[model samples]
Target chain A: MTDHIHDEHCDHEHEAGINWQLVQGWVQTGILIIMGLYFIDLALPGGQLGNYINVDNFGWLTWVGAAIFLSMGIINAADLLRTRPEEHHHDHSHEHDHEHASAGSLSSWIFLGIATIPLIFGLGVPSKPLSADAISGDLSTNVSTINFGTSQSSIDIPSEQRNILDWIKAFSQSSDLREFEGQAVDVIGFVYKDAQLRGTDDFMVVRFTMSCCVADARPFGLVVDFPTGQEFSQDTWIQVKGHIEIRSIDGIDTPVILADSVEVTSQPEQPYLYF
Target chain B: MEFDLTIFATRFLGIFIEATPFLLLGTLASGLIEAFVNKDDIARMVPHNPVLATIMGGMLGFMFPVCECGVVPVTRRLYKKGLPLSTGIAFLLAAPVMNPVVVASTYAAFGAGPVLYGRYIMTALVAIGVGLIFTVQNRPQRILRPQAIFVPITGGSEAVMPAESERMELLPGIKKALLLAHEEFFEMGRYLIFGSLLAAAMGTLALDKEIETLASNPVNSVFVMQASAFILSVCSTVDAFLALAFANTFTTGSILSFLVFGPMVDIKSTMMFLGVFKRRVVFYLIALPFLLTALLSIAINLNIRL
Candidate 1:
């Protein structure tokens, strides 16, 4: 009895001194609070608040995780199998190295907060993509609302020269696109192969490449009615020039620049079209 | 209060769904790795050749893929199981970038390109570089000890002690598997909840319009945006589209920086790093990626003809 009591005391003294109950309680409470917040987000509508049901992509991963964890738990059980119950159970002194996984230094958080400041203030709060009816959730919604229906012309270019909408938007807004629209504005972008648009010797969908952050990207391309042209593979970036013509593609009003001609630009010094 | 609360709730939930695919994949991959991979076997494979070891460490991730979000917990496990710190660090950095899932997602998002190849190559090199640094400078004893498992009881519900009699009984593999699954689900699930929420808040409340405007500048914009990317706590899979949206506003350098930095360091992942590794280690690890990205972005910009 004395040995048992001493062993218990020694086990207590060795380490992991904090009661598991207390730690578990803290973790559980924190999780519960967070889960509640997620639930609240789910109940609300619109992105202005938050969306909670993001588990779709992650659902499979979670199940896979459960399987993996089960495997580990079993392995651990196997490791513990050989030890005597008394030695394993009652009281075993624990040793703690006393090193902590750093929570991050004060300077780090300050730097982090400083870094995050721009993202907070830089972009307008983004709403979901514009609907067909058009909801001006923000002031920008008003921009699209104006005169979008004014011009609809089909400026056919060879399929080799269509541009991504992201680039087109940028070009439309840029000095290059606005001033040089008719002056043979040459831009480099990638071809997006559309099966439906294939075999038409005019207008290949092109996309400007951005390494990251897709918000400000525009996709505008050359509308080439190539009398005799070769089929350019999809995702190929080519420098092509044509006069700008605003028209409708597949019911949506889009810009169709008539490519006077197309040139296969070698992978330029800059490989991608930055918005 | 009611109006603000309603808007906040709705927005928060929207971001949560956006991040779901990433969060679930990261956690599941992490959980799977922790269960099956034997640490001792991995550690023994590290060779005297630094280059080989690094590549081996990075590539090994395909087989024993893990998540950066759960890096600390898993790293701690590796330490306990006797993995070399250098290899472990390499795996920590490389696994997030080079793993099968992240690679597949990147291919899907960006399409196969020099960019896709660049991400893979660059991450591998960077991870190796950091691992090499650790190898030369620090010893294992200084950083971590063996992994420790704990049990506790409350209100006299049960005695808080290691299982004794049942320790050696090799239960049917199925029985043992079920118990582990239960523990891991609860342990890791809780953290996933916290991490996803934090990521959602960053995406929603913080990344606003004004920030986008600042990112439009060609000169100071890339650094600022890249820095923001590091802190945003977003997953790599979805961030590509978000980065594309910013492409028009910011310089190429900033965009590259954003993509490169975000995958390596973020709010929750940083916390996860700290939770599992020494603070000094996490700090250094985080710093290396940002530094390399800045340089790489500059190079890409200077050489970019378009």
Candidate 2:
């Protein structure tokens, strides 16, 4: 497919003096190199890669992509240096189909522009993880349906050490909410309040768990009951020191955290929890 | 809600980072096929009978193992190397969902139950059904773009041979493959990026919130899921987990439609398809699978339980 371009360029070699084909090749080569460096930067520690994706699942794949891009760029650089314009003319002499050559150059430039859209967004826009505003439909409070490991083993973990996901898993496996009564709870998550919890002294302390990226992000939370729960606005990251109590939420028996304290905290470096 | 640029950028980069490796692998394979594989070999391996050939095409994913993002370039390259028309079409549609990686992921998400089996069975039926439709107008000139067709429509035994000077030894072939891979990468990479941009924009705008309203209606839910699948353009290997998020709220058929149809045709894969097939053929590629999967899923919704 590429041979046609070189063959076409031979026709305009003398008239143009500049090999537009070579310039196009170098542009692509530069784009590949920059793209390679971008992926490598994301894979590094403290990089913003996790803000977008679950790095645990795709961290190594990012490195593989970097290698592929860098290697392809280097190979193209080598090819452009080794092969003279005259050699390309001779190598693809018979493959010239001139009708599409003019159209091909125009379309190739358009494609090159299209290929840079990600780079424009990746560099130009500041990275931010999805927050409560990203919640599209109803918040997932039902713990029974999710397959977040139903071994009844997470309950054994000390209350202070367990995160939102661990608590949800424990809730999923236990037959009764009373089993978690008075369990000391210390977890950090963002506050999410919907219409139902707006008037009451309750709101959801939620964290999104993703098996892949944010496209599949599913929110899981336990209802928090505080006298001033409404004061902690939506999507405010907070550390809740509390104890679990069985309460009837919308007439369904569920575990609700009764908070001793709620302190505002900064978002974690890795915002989304991975299963 | 107003468009959030930050969220759009995050989602765009995430989708691109997750998908690009597969696209690179695809172009690399395309390059290798261009360098090493002979057209005669592809012609020889495919079954002569059209029906068997189409079925074999749907099954080819076990060997190639490309998702929707990677399948287009590989399918185009295979076409260039003299793969039959129906078989190539079938592979293009089925390989994304039929591969082992997707199977394992779907099984992990849904278990060995109706959703898992329904996905594979539905994909095979739709893909092969579309492939068979191509057999009616089996001429390459009718279906493929001019640049995609390499071998003449003559019988396989009379395949055209490359010039002796064009053939290469192992080391040179490897170099040639890399060079071709570089070119193919740029050719196909643009489509992936463009599709990601559209998917990201739609995601940031929260268009899915509008679709969620239609989920309660059984028939509307199937089309709604299909629209979500097309817009989201998530990778097939991990999309099962995404579908799991909707397992409770969505009907069985709609969820199955998302699993089966998402892999075959999405914004990204459709853009890539435009690179290989004629403009009209791309329409059929999208429509054929969409209609077939919808009809079958609705049938399952109305009749079957699981």
lDDT of each residue in B62-120, candidate 2, tens digit only? 99999888888899889878898999999999999989999998988788999999999
Angstrom error of the Cα, residue A63, model 2: value is 1.0
Off by over 4 Å in 1: A1-50, A54-275, B1-40, B144-219, B304-306
Which is the leading candidate under DockQ? 2
Return the clash pairs for model 2, or none: none
What C-alpha lDDT do the candidate models reach, one value each? 0.47, 0.80
Model 2 residue runs over 4 Å out of place are A1-15, A89-107, A138-158, A228-234, B152-167, B204-218, B304-306
Measured with DockQ on alpha carbons, how good is candidate 2?
A: 0.44
A-chain TM-score, model 1? 0.33
What are the per-model C-alpha RMSD values against the true structure?
14.7, 4.2
Supply the TM-score for candidate 2: 0.89
Root-mean-square deviation of Cα positions for candidate 2 versus the true structure, in angstroms: 4.2
**Model 2 chain A worst lDDT window (10 residues):** A90-99
